[model samples]
Target: MPTPSYPPKPSPGDRIAVVSPSSGLPGLFPRPYELGLARLREEFGLEPVEYPATRRMGATPQERADDLHAAFADPEVKAVVASIGGDDQITVLPLLDRELLRSCPKPFFGWSDNTNLLAFLYDCGVVGYHGGSVMCELGRPGAMHPMTAESLRAALFTSGPYELRPAERWNDVDRDWADPATFESEPRSRPGGGWSWINADRVVEGRSWGGNLEILSWLLMADRAIARDESAYDGGVLILETSEELPGATEVFRILRCMGERGLLRRFPALLTARAKSWSFERPNNPQQAARYAADQRAAVERALRAYAPDTMAVFDVDFGHTDPQLVIPYGGTVRVDGPARRITVTY
Candidate 1:
């Protein structure tokens, strides 16, 4: 495959497409969706253009693909962002027109299930973004996290190397988006312990490859996004993070092991394991339980690495996945993991 190039950045006044290529949670909870749209206009100074499937829950794959095609094909649309991510986005992958998107590459930002789209864009030779969902990040309860807002602003407008900073205060817990009371106050967060580096011996620079762990597992099962030639990932940084579903440590280990079995795990020399999302509305884990969850997840990762990529350098708890104060990572773009300096930088 050819080297992936960064898509053009959008100006403040430019229009952006906000579509729900996956799940349309905006229909179920309009509060955050509207608030997110307002922020896009007021704070970002960008007009958010929503497609028909943007707020329509249970939109079929064809409808979502049509919205994506329309969004990318429109000259007025300078960027494309997801309203939110949900399951079943893998179904939409088959319907996308590679040549159409390649003809008009735009910065696409979304995480969680949107991993499918990012990976797809990478293979299409266009760089996408791995964060900044509308309802979750922009419409975050109370106010946007300072770190998140700053990182997103830079990615949206600028194109250059940007150093990533670990969040001083991070949140794993989430409030009910459906409840009006959830919007009255900010979600709770805890003091961050910063990132922990393992095998911090050398710096590694390469494009990023990987996303929400569970989502990637699904893609692997479907034989989607991931390169058939394992060498396509050679020297690239592997990024992995779990979502709010709170899959157990054993599950994490099993998935990585499967990748290793396929000769895909040891290709990347470095790994950036996102801070695990510990608390969820379904499983309101206490502080102690949350800590255990994080610890076990880390242990599982270590166990898998020892068996597969034993020499790979790893940095755990980087705030970029399902965590609050999410950082924007450049999908298919350059990432410099400076193990010796204990810093991570990405090309925006």
Candidate 2:
């Protein structure tokens, strides 16, 4: 595939489309959604314009696709951001008018289920951002994470190479958005264990691909947004992260195993696995359990890569997805993974 082109960055006062391509949780829980919008205006100095389906629950796939089409087609909307990610965005992919998006080519920011759109945009030859959902990162309960804010601002305004730094402290814990206390202060965070590296001898520079692991599994199963030939991904940086619905180590290994079986694992020489999200409302794991969870996840990744792509350089706990102080990663854009230098840089 050809190198995808990035759309122009949005100016501070420019209007940005905020759409819900997946779930309309914004309507159900407006607290974080509203707070996210406020921050977009106050912190980023950008105006967020919402489409009809942005907050509409049970919106049809066509309706969601329409919102995306409108967002990209609108001349005034410089960028498009997802309100949040959901489970069923793959269904909306077929409803999208590819020609419309191909022509308009606006910058899109999202992760998780939004991986569907990011992969779609990549196939369409337009670069999209893999992180920065409004509800999760922007609508963060208390204040925006300093690292997240800085990474987001750079991705939004700048158009150059940006180096990613490991978060000194990161949080995987969650707060009840409905509870007023959640917004009172920052969520407690633990000291970062730091990134774990395997095969740290070389540097690899290439375009980026991949997203939430479970979502990518679904995409691979459905054969959506994936290139017809696995070779299309050769030299691309593979980024993978687990969501709040944390899949166990065995499950993680199974997904990667499938990718390997399909000849996908050998295509990329560098991999960036995100910090595992161990705690959720449904399963409130203590710090000890969280530590074990992350350790197991790391081992699972190593096992998969060892079996499939033994020489691939891999880094874990990089804090890019489903974790606090998340960094922004460019999908279909350039990423340089320097294992020898212990540095990762992305071209926005």
Model 1: residue 288 alpha-carbon error in angstroms: 0.5
lDDT tens string, model 2, 1-348?
556889889999999999999999999989899999999999999999999999999999999999999899999999999999999999999888887988899889999999999999998889999889898899998799999999999999999999999999998888888887888888898888788898999999999999999999999999898887668799999999999998999999999999999889999999999989999999899889988988899899999998999999998889899999999999999999999999999999
Best by lDDT: 1
Error of 1 at 283 (Å): 1.1
TM-score of each: 0.99, 0.99
lDDT of 1 by residue, 1-348 (tens): 667898888999999999999998999999999999999999999999999999998889999999999999999999999999998899999999999999899999999999999999988899999999999999999989889999999999998999998888988878778889999988877899999998999999998999999999999999997776769889999999899999999999999999999888799999999999988889999999999999999999999999999999999999899999999999999999999899999999
Tell me the RMSD of model 1 versus the true structure. 0.8
